[model samples]
Target: MTTNLPLPQFYSQILSTLQPIFDDTLPLSDPSTQSTLTSALDNLYLIQRMINSLGVFSENESIDEVGEKEIVFMSLNWVIGAAEEKGGLGGRDDRLSALQRAETAYTSYLEILNSYGVLSPEEQAESSAAASGQSSTPKDPAKKREAKIRQYKREKELRENIANSLPNQPESSSSPITFLLCLLPSTSNRPSVISASTGSTSVNQEDPDEVSKSTAILILRLLHTITIASLSSISMEMELLSNAPASIVPLSDRDPREVRREEEDNTWKLDRQPSKYKPRELISGNGRVLRPFTILPSTSDMSDRERLKSGVFKQSWRLPTMTIDEYLEEEQRRGNIITGGGQASYDAPTESELLELAAENDGSALAEEKAEQKRLKDENWARFADENKKGAGNTMNKG
Candidate 1:
């Protein structure tokens, strides 16, 4: 019962421009309205065709995977916006129940997006760390709140500054999209992603990449949902078959005991189960529960010696199977070699040893050395005296 899905061709940009007009003129079915509806449908079909070109199987995709695609989101947005048009799929006034059902389905889909948490601690810290070139893990509740506050303040200040710097002209508010763009956070680095901005909203595009990524993701998620809804019947049939027993296996042949055992095994246990031993609690001297001591790492701890000293570091790989005696023996051998097998003493040198060293120093043929020096000094003095006397005699002769 599978029909070949039609591939429509039209530019996304062109189709996007007509959305407002369609919304305004809906509930009417004149020639112009019909033509407009036809054109819009054509545009939607074209976009779907382009998306179908990717050959994605909705059944095989996880929600996250589908969410990451742009076209799926676009398709979903289109479905939500145009599904209730006068002559569209859920258009009949008499089929109000069907429209309500569709709305419920779409709302459920949106809940998935809405239920997403704000930037998680890890994500926020990672983004901050990437920007600041530091690892910032906030362990304390107060610090975590402070980090979030700081992030919000920083982003707000950045946006305000950018807004203030823009030319103060009437064109500043001319486009809702541009206004929204001006409202985007300054931390965003992608300004080119504004190409996907829909429904006459010209984004200020401070960060095109961020806008584009966000828009693309939104569109992809929508498309994924639309695709899923379209194929839900098929999916249900498959699911039923999977859960059904094979035609070859009759229900009567199954063992009742085995079925009962499986049922018992699959049953959930009670929350307060009986334990083999009573629970033990440590109490403080004052009678309160004794909580174990905990260390909360500070910024200084991350940047300083504490970080280096905190963790246990292994210098070598250890074989877990090695015996403690073997390790101790190896250590003893190394220790003996290093310390000279108890030959080295911690005691200081005695007076006797000091005196012995001094005596050895002077006793080493020292008398001969001193005598030689004295002899050299006397010979030099006698030579000088003889030269002086000769000089005196010469002077007397000259006179």
Candidate 2:
């Protein structure tokens, strides 16, 4: 006695719940955003379970032959999108885990597409070339480094993979509700259904074609973008963990035994008992030593108490090596300055002076009249000077 899956109802709920993601006006900070998204994820997870319960998917099953191919493809897309928004959904424990789940789901979908022979000849050849390192990426060192990093992330995700975790075949005796609860791993612990109503979404049943294959490639690229950033973050976190001291909890909260062990760890111990003590430069400021010691400041650092920061640049005036005159002299030597007369100091007469001398020598009526006026002027000057003698006027400073 088999129980039918209530996919129609779940589909309706999934469509209504997912409407928020497509809404442009919806604010992420809205109180209902997370609640609505959580509900949507639950319905989407239920859909996955429903599809899995039909036993229609397998390593040998081609996407063209599958009835729920479109639904599965879109579901993978939506799941990945949700993972980007909330970090994880339903049974997923964290953001990274959620991304891994999405990656796994998309990869499985791609496998089915490949089996269906949906890729074009050119695309297939390009993919093959990339696999063989012919030219999927550029020859630039930066691009190569990026490719290596992504490859590392991809390989790591694959190695520590967690698949969709579905049943291999359909169970006739099991009800889908029970199968759902069983398959979900933690349905009770996951988000509860907020609301469900009558809704509809168009389901495509077209055979795999070039357009569909192009869409698959797009989805792959989307997954790549979302996963790389998250994987890089995860890698950084792991690096931090490796570098961090071995204590996650506060000293007070740590176990006495652990604290004792940590305290003991600080004490030095030799792997081999040395027969004699040898003087060695174990620590130095120079690069010769692997472990360098901090050079303590003299008494002045404590006296000043500036608490000066390292690595921060502060502009300052350096002590003058020479006076302003010296600097100006150097600049003058470099042809940056000029003094005295640049050209007026020459002994040669200028053209304007020569023209003035010629005008004085030229005998014209104007010159004769100017000479008579000059003689009158000289006589008038002599008479005025004789009249106004040095002590004649009652000046304040008279002798």
Candidate 3:
């Protein structure tokens, strides 16, 4: 015959009782308080019997029941001990204080039950043997020491392996200037004063686009300065070393510009310009020194009427004019060119060449004549078609 168990109901009662004790707003005068307190006391008694049923201590209680009881007992004891040690359950008039005290006493009882339940049959035998003055051989001390050493070595090896598995990080280049540059405003208000001493009229007033461009230029300059400073420091360090490689010592000690050029040459291979146009040497007024041509705007003093009549304002195009040497220098600085090639082949088209090209394409009067002939032909065709349609309709009506 099978016997029904009351374990589920018992566990449910314990949970239901403990739930109200954890609720802060529940009043002492409330009817549920009496029920809650009664349930709590009853659950504590049931828990002790449950431990006895578990054969955790020499068949006195089953293993499962004993384990569950021991866990709950230890947890409750810890909470109650903490609360009492903190002096959090001393007041008499406070309902929570009284509940806490009750719970503490229950916890202490549960701890005693747990301690009794944890004493295994072998341990009890050992204790009895000790009380009777029967000497039992102790465990080997050397083996225990060896085991501890092996455990420590295993843990150390595991930690080292973990550290080695992590990726190596590059050295940080953070500095005060880097931090300031990062925090600098990307764009500033227009008409910013250059200095306190400068008048308002002397200030550089920039729109949003100009402000952004200027800020970007400033950041690039700062980065360039930091790179150069770092390179110089490395050079100084190399100079102090006695056994440095010859290449390292000489290259490191070179000027920042030369170092930059070497670095660029290693990274970029220059491509030759396309060869469609013939290159020309620009001559200066002295006739000996080659000079670049400069394109200037027509004198700006002309009236609006005069500018319109001359068609100068309507047909004008603006081209950037800079010396060939200056252009070559800029290209070299940008790593766009390596060789100091003499000059650019491309030049601005002259005024006479432009006028000749326009004259070659001119067909204004001939186009007008063709359009007039087409219009007359279309008008005559329309009138003849209308007359033919009227004659056909009259003939059909007469028949």
Candidate 4:
């Protein structure tokens, strides 16, 4: 008999409970917020169980990345909503405290994944054979050297494999919960400043579009920074693991029986020496080895939905909020700075200077008009002279 999966229902319930809370503004003290949070948390528990159970049927499946993403999204609502005084869990200080705990848990989970090592099937088989003592035992110095070299090669390969398996940004097949998580920060506190401006003290309180636009941009930036930091951290951890000493066996506790034998009858022996194997450079999937704390290129792209709304919100994204009179005064000041003299070296025009400038302009206009009239007079005189010359030529022909 085919068994039904509970994940779909779990997701549905989470959506149902969280959707209402997300859609409306309710007070933190309201009973509905608590009830909704409880429901969402319960559904999240189910989702976690389902994620854990993924490995049961698919041996090769690694749901670690997906599980981390799932839980992060599940926790974001609480993290964001719990701190809001209105329509949030803010009234209770304990819930706000819980947000910090949730953040710590998220960080710890990512760290665990970074540190965990998984051996491949081939490596596992080799290790099993060596542990069982079924492989050829080193009977000479050359054989011992060969064994050490082989082990080193295997370890290098393993490190390369692990490094290649870095986590990626969310894909299209990712749950809608990811987008919802992205929108969570809209409910969080607005920054004192959004776009940088020298004179602007705060964001425009009048424009809701501007507020939403700034909030969205902030969320995208936060996501980008977080993801880059996480990847860089994981890369550093891998590098450290690769460079760390393989073991710490003391010289006094040396086991003679386990040492390489040069002869079957123990007539000859070789000194035990460490392998001198140098590892190759570790590169990521993109062929770049990231240094510790190196900022990766931003993977977060604002969605199409955000782009559509940008026209409305970002219309004045950089513009400062001020009264009409203040705006006019600022503009006039800027004009004076630019036109009065370079770098505001000249003071504002006095009444006499303004009159002089007006007179100069009037005189220039009059001079141009007179020049045009003179040109027309010259043309008329020339036409009259030509007419007279033609009359004189006609009279001469008659004579």
lDDT of 3 by residue, 265-369 (tens): 534222233433222333332444253345323435557777467444432432224445655654566566665334452365554454444445446765555
lDDT of 1 at 234: 29
Task: Identify the runs in model 4 with alpha carbons over 4 angstroms from their true place.
Answer: 1-5, 53-93, 108-399
- Candidate 4: which pairs clash? 26-87
* Poorly placed runs, candidate 3 (over 4 Å): 1-9, 53-70, 76-399
lDDT of each: 0.40, 0.43, 0.38, 0.39
On TM-score, who's better, 1 or 4? 1
Q: What is the C-alpha RMSD of each candidate to the true structure, in Å?
A: 27.6, 22.4, 36.4, 30.7
Give stretches of model 2 more than 4 Å off. 1-9, 15-40, 58-74, 77-96, 121-139, 142-253, 256-399
**Model 4 lDDT tens row, 14-81:** 55445445445444457867766665665555554655666322334443433332333333333232
In terms of lDDT, the best-performing candidate is 2
TM-scores for the candidates? 0.25, 0.34, 0.19, 0.24
Model 2: per-residue lDDT, tens digit, 81-112?
44344434332234445555544544444344
TM-score of 4: 0.24
Q: State the displacement of the C-alpha of residue 144, model 1, in Å, after optimal TM-score superposition.
A: 34
Q: Least lDDT summed over 10 consecutive residues: which range in candidate 1?
A: 168-177
